[model samples]
Target: MTKNTTINYREKIEHSHVYDVAKITPLEFQPNLSARINNRVLLKREDMQPVFSFKLRGAYNKMASLPTDTLKRGVIAASAGNHAQGVAMSAQKLGCRAVIVMPTTTPLIKINAVKARGAEVILFGDSYSDAYVKALELEKSEQLTFVHPYDDPDVIAGQGTIALEILNAHPEPIEAIFCCVGGGGLLAGIAAYVKAVRPEIKIIGVEAKDAEAMTESLKQGKRVMLDQVGLFADGAAVKQVGEHTFALSQQYVDEMIVVDNDAICAAIKDVFEDTRSILEPAGALATAGLKEYAKRNNLSGKTLVGIASGANMNFDRLRFIAERAEVGEKREAVLAVTIPEKPGAFKTFCRLLGDRNITEFNYRYSDPKEAHIFVGVAIADPNESANLVADLIAQGLPALDLTDNEVAKLHLRHLVGGHAPQAENEVVFRFEFPEKPGALMKFLDTMGHDWNISLFHYRNHGADFGRVLVGMQVPPNEQTEFAEFLQNLGYPHWDETHNPAYKLFLG
Candidate 1:
């Protein structure tokens, strides 16, 4: 965090050899995004890199600067994502033997990509941390040089070249430069160069709200490890930021913004609309943060820049992203409305919509006296959802907004069923765990016949994690024991027993 460290990093970036293997990505102005937000928006196209990510800059620079004798001995690194590809390609370019340790759960496409670059791929363990431990052991046993993904000085300096490029591309007055934070390599590198050179320009970092290690670290005045991270933005999901990156970010980053998965999906769509290019969740992170920051501050007429970090998107995820983008963009509202079950009530409900397009509607006959419906309505303004809910209430129809409810958006809309009258003492809970073979079986085995499962729902979104909503029937006397069971289950969970959406449709 010292000024001396900042100067050292800036100097290293100024003379980095990243350009030996990494290309100079363009900083193109986004006209569509600019006009829509009423501010000039520029995108740093790192997604166009040879490895389809900015990771190559750091990985190559670190390897290219190594001593020839050391390179002959080979190198090793552990990563399950973009970093692995960066190292593989860099090693191929440098003609050095490279060994990459990746999780066993990594996709075959990624494994093949690394092997195609002539690097040796070793799949071990079930997560990055486990693979990292294996890599360390191999490094010592095989006497190979280890490449620390984001923690090393050389790597940080190489990543800093991005900031230098951004400044040279746009010399005009700028409002802020947004960078997405994972292990803090990208953001820390950008912040170091910007703060050292363009002190007047703001340097902001963006992170998923569920995986905000840097944000939490800066707030706590130290690096804090998270118990778990949401895997939707897996590219930027880090339990802890790197030591060097954390120190630099602590002193250089001006501000940090946290956004959710919905916002990320919307940002992906935003970029697609502007440039006809699709970005992965982490790649669109800074764009999402930029939109939120601009709206929150109400600033306009100034230039803003966002890093489109990568585009290694999974094809299977497009459907889920498309479904959530509308909600994220405030273009759609999901609601639960109750009305009299008498004849013509359904017609009255449609009449109340009054030309407002219904994106989706689901109803099930639950009670003789009342009816509950799940609905999705299109809206141009974000405030229109609250207004519509109020109007529905005024008309004597009770309405609850499920636009912000994770449970409702993820599962409830697909499950509109009559209440389970015979299911007694049922408690609904949502859970997330790393997706892998036998994961669900492990969950079931952990339950161990302690409670009967009344209802269950799960759908894959092509993410590293799996989400499940379960209703369990636990006797009142065993509530304390059930609490202990959940505590020891080792999965992130939320109690949704009293959730309004659950009560209306399936309680």
Candidate 2:
């Protein structure tokens, strides 16, 4: 409950019982990333754990430390990710009953994995917080020991063993160690050990920008609860950092870095190139942070290490990750160019590109005077995108960069046909709906047939939510009524009515 000086994290970590169920994962050298970043890089391969996550270390240690009577009664946990498997596998290894409460919205693959490990699975609520509440109720009612995902002292100590392993395996100098923070358990544990044993080694925590609970918490000198967290890296999407973990992080963490989803995808690719292992978004967070940190500081020839936390990637999400990897690495530039609709226009554009590889080209003749084309070009340097745009403008082709535009990348790139000139008063909106049955029907039923549907685009990227881009014909007089409709919908929505991509393509 409090950061007591009496709690010896080093002693607890040194004597952790994790080896009974968790493996001592390899600290492997990354040749590709090392060569590319000009730094000696090593990856702590926690992804190679028995349950394919470092979570087993903490889970097993916590369970093994429990009293005999408590273990006999059983253990309960709430998680929709690696923690659930960690607890389940630990329970199986200990020959104790385990019950895991998971969100109903959790993927079937994960649910089945826990069940396969011989743990009773209870699908409850819509999110991890909701499931956690249910788990507490069940824990009290059934007299089950609650195995917290990260907040417990035993759990933090268990995770700290990773720091011991890294320091023992590589006795050489380590400039910094990067690890991802969700509820701050992983970073908290690692930082606590590193700071105590090797204070000179920097312990940096990485988080997704949209789900930066630890970053904000450390900034305000307290734990801050977020209203919502982006689920791209669902493993590290906790809205609030755990109390014990936050306390440890406050004392030991050196720096906090936030990265976007694109960088995470690129980090996945980086790991795959060196190790041929695919890491989930959260698993790749530390690598992404390491790359950013190295580039930002312009540090070369330093020994850097990152923890590859887990590899429980959903097969369906690969398509989306692969597509964003190029942009994240600054290897692809997306642009919208306006060229005269005449013969040899394409040739002239190609000439201007000057041997640069074209990744994608989407075009449809809309106007006799001009043509708007969506283009993706390969670039070796990040600065090349600006230079290429300048070249286009100098050659009389007006070019707009859409590489950073969410609307352009998610919707406009696919809807690059001729505009609907006849759809009067058309307004575009992007909506996120829960990826469940009848979600679309619910949206349509609430819409109430007041406006005409002019355009619609929906794509499933194997995420928890379904993203849809919609265009509707609403009269100016009813703008207030349309606004009220969106508010009542209860779904996250963004207005793209004036987005340049829509204006140039579908508007």
Candidate 3:
């Protein structure tokens, strides 16, 4: 029945009323990034859109194109992030009753934003896929029109308008256009217009390394579903590429690249440094791919365009971004070094570093024989971290690079050395300390050093609270006392004695 359902995506895009809620965002040249990569890197600022994302274009177009009868009955969509805002804003514009189903874990900011736009927010399961199933059920029971975030021709056409504006402003040829692919609607839409209008322009799709459903689908020549997707880039954390979007992308996209969270965080910093705007993890993914592509090909003096997709980041998440950005950009190297506990041991270690700026330093004077120091040093480039590690190892310092260790990055960074075998009845627990002065002192005083601190780690995240991992040694007979101690301590803690990473690294 629907051999021609795909229709002319390009024709629909050309006639789209995306400008109703969207705008022709600026295509700003990124001189700093361009100079660093030795390419004419430009950012298509879709982040400047009213809803702070290109999602509005598709959401508005889909709602606007609906028959008058359907519009009267209202629309429904499932999204935990940008798409929810898009539909809410679109619904407000069209004066329709919009229902947005979001995951239970969705941030309060997003939930409230949708509510502010007059959409009824229903918290469903823990992911977009779960919310999608619930939304489909509601569409039938409530008789609401399901407005898909990606997949649909109207949505794809709305997103495709980005390509039209990009080419219109810069009639000159672009070597490659990098885009982030979640459900594949944005990438598919842009690919349609670019492939049709400027067939020579390369359309490269980027995906989070941990969430590469679209990449896998493109490689296998069919749609592929991942059992699970990472939530770091929550906006692009789609488990499977849309069927229609995947089919269209296979024809239009030239290549695909997958980058890790570090690169995405680094790219976020890059955009912030250049445009003075911080983007969500998914928002900076396209630029991350662009930088990676330029480095891999060693291409210079070429024009590379990246869609800076959105800036709807929660302010608190910036702390995590800043922490990882250095490693992602290869600007900092984190290391765990065991130096002799003698008088000149620390001095000699500092001498070895020789003029390198110490970005961070956390040391615990535990053993009289040797001390362990968690250090982060400024680096010149991507390879410098490895080079520095090699230099330390060659110098007979038992050094281990903790740059890529998940446990080290999250917990161990502040944690003191592993389990103390000598201490009886050792217990390891993770805690969150209120981020105010004297909080640490309050704990120490409350615990009273009577228990003998076996391990402790804490780092400030520039927020209202700090995360800590602690290991305390207590005698078996003192178990009752320890329980009473914890209740009296009044600070929350989680036991991590059996964590695999702990056993591997510290046990």
Task: Give the number of the best model, judged by lDDT.
Answer: 2
Q: Please give the ranking of all candidate structures by TM-score, highest first, separated by commas.
A: 1, 2, 3
Give each model's whole-structure lDDT.
0.91, 0.92, 0.85
What's the CA error at residue 342 for candidate 3, in Å?
A: 1.4
Candidate order (lDDT)? 2, 1, 3
Worst 10 residues of 2 by lDDT: 1-10
Which should have the higher lDDT, number 2 or number 3?
Answer: 2
Model 1 C-alpha lDDT per residue in residues 143-166, reported as the tens digit of each score: 899998888888888888999999
Model 3: per-residue Cα lDDT over 1-507, one tens digit each: 232244887799999977878989999999899889999999999999998999999999999999999999999999987899999999999999999998775767788988998999998875577899999999999999999999888898899999999999999979999999999999989998998899999999999988999999988887888866666777888878887788888888999999998899999999998999988889999999999999999998999999989888888878888899998998888888888899988988999898899998987666788777888999998588888888888887878777876557778765545545566666777776654557788888887658877777765543334668877777788888788777777665667777654553465
Which is better, 1 or 2, measured by lDDT?
A: 2
* Reference-based TM-score of each model: 0.97, 0.96, 0.85
Reference-based lDDT, residue 365, model 2: 80
- The stretch of ten residues in a row with the least summed lDDT in candidate 3 is 458-467
Off by over 4 Å in 2: 1-6, 476-484
Candidate 3's C-alpha runs over 4 A off are 1-6, 422-505
